[model samples]
Target: MKKFNSTIYMSGKYLFVGMLLLALLGSCGNNADKTNDTGKQKREQLPAQAGKEKAKTIVFFGNSLTAGYGVDPSEAFPALVQEKIDSLHLPYKVVNAGLSGETTAGGKSRIDWILRQPVDIFVLELGGNDGLRGIPIAETSRNLQAIISRVREKNPQVKIVLAGMQVPPNMGRTYASAFRVVFQQLAANNQIDLIPFLLENVGGISHLNQADGIHPNPQGHKIVAENVWRVIQGLL
Candidate 1:
């Protein structure tokens, strides 16, 4: 009887120890699972955090000049501007929204589509086509104003830069003067920044222009980029 009792007591002791060991192992497994879950959550959040730090966008909306007509797209002034920004390590991404022959009226029609994406700085380079086409000064002004209004409506914080242009003397001095005045008036009235002349040094120079004498060549684009940088650097 004594031996049997001792055997029974030993069996009970072993069973309790086994159960304690199992409980300890289960607790360790739960702690490890909790740590792994936390690590997984942090990994998932990393991309979202990085996305928040992505570069801001600058939209250069214009016509053939901005499109780099008769030249490689990389040789365009907007691309040159991008190169300058990159060289300075600026936190901006330049979007060249330059359609080859877009006028102010056309730009007005499509401004909403362009605004579908976020635009931090908006460089308006229309009106040159309007001048070339001999569009009415009032009509051009109204279209440009409407585009500006729409941009402001979409994003009140957007910084606007209007590029001033002058029609050829052949377009008539009065008409040419009025065309040039439109940009100044709009810039003052809207309280926006202005690029006094987008093609300042490159406009009438035969060597600086392409064979067409209207669009800038690669060398001219470098000067245009400098012109743009002077105006936009302060804003940046």
Candidate 2:
């Protein structure tokens, strides 16, 4: 009888030990599953965060000159910028938002829609129409200010490169000075990059300009590209 009791006690103790080991193993398995699930979630979220570390985007916003006025779209300044980015293998996208005959007011009106995308840089070129139509310089300046403010509201850190325009001397010295000052003052106050004139090399030269004497020819577009590239490269 004593031997049988001892045998039963031993059997009970072994069974309890086995059950405890099984429970510990099950707990470890559950912890491993949880760790794997966490890692998968982190992997899934990685792609979305990847682009932020790649490169920035550039957006060209302006009027007829920006629309490749007299030049082919591929030979335009914006295209040249795209080419530069490609040749350098820079992970960037240059977007053209040019519209022929757009004034500062028109640009202001359309800016909200244009800014719907992720724009890392804005190359602003407007107010030529205001100069042509003899609009008040103050009004043109105000419109441009509003556009800048709107962009700032969307992104406080957005970099702006303003492509300034010079009116014909035929418009009178006072008007021309006012028009130029609109860009100068804004650039100074906002601490943004400024291209003194979009048509620096093509302006007033019949050979470089198209039949309209307003738009630039292909060779002229190359010069414009150089002008823009100078400022953009420095900032970047």
Q: How accurate locally is residue 101 in candidate 2, as Cα lDDT from 0 to 100?
A: 91
Over the stretch 1-236, how does candidate 1's per-residue lDDT look in tens digits?
99999999999999999999999999999999999999999999998897666799999999989988988999998999899888987889999999988999899999999999999999999999889889999999999999999999999999999999988988999999999999999999999999999999999999999888899999999899999999999988
Write model 2 residue lDDT over 35-120, tens digit each, in one string. Answer: 99999999998987874566777989999888897678998889998898889767788999999999999999999999999888
What local distance difference test score does each model get?
0.94, 0.89
**TM-score (all chains, Cα) for each model:** 0.78, 0.77
- Predicted structure 1: clash tally: 0
**lDDT score at residue 59, model 1, on the 0-100 scale:** 99
Which residue pairs does candidate 2 place in steric collision? none
TM-score between model 2 and native? 0.77
Error of 1 at 153 (Å): 0.2
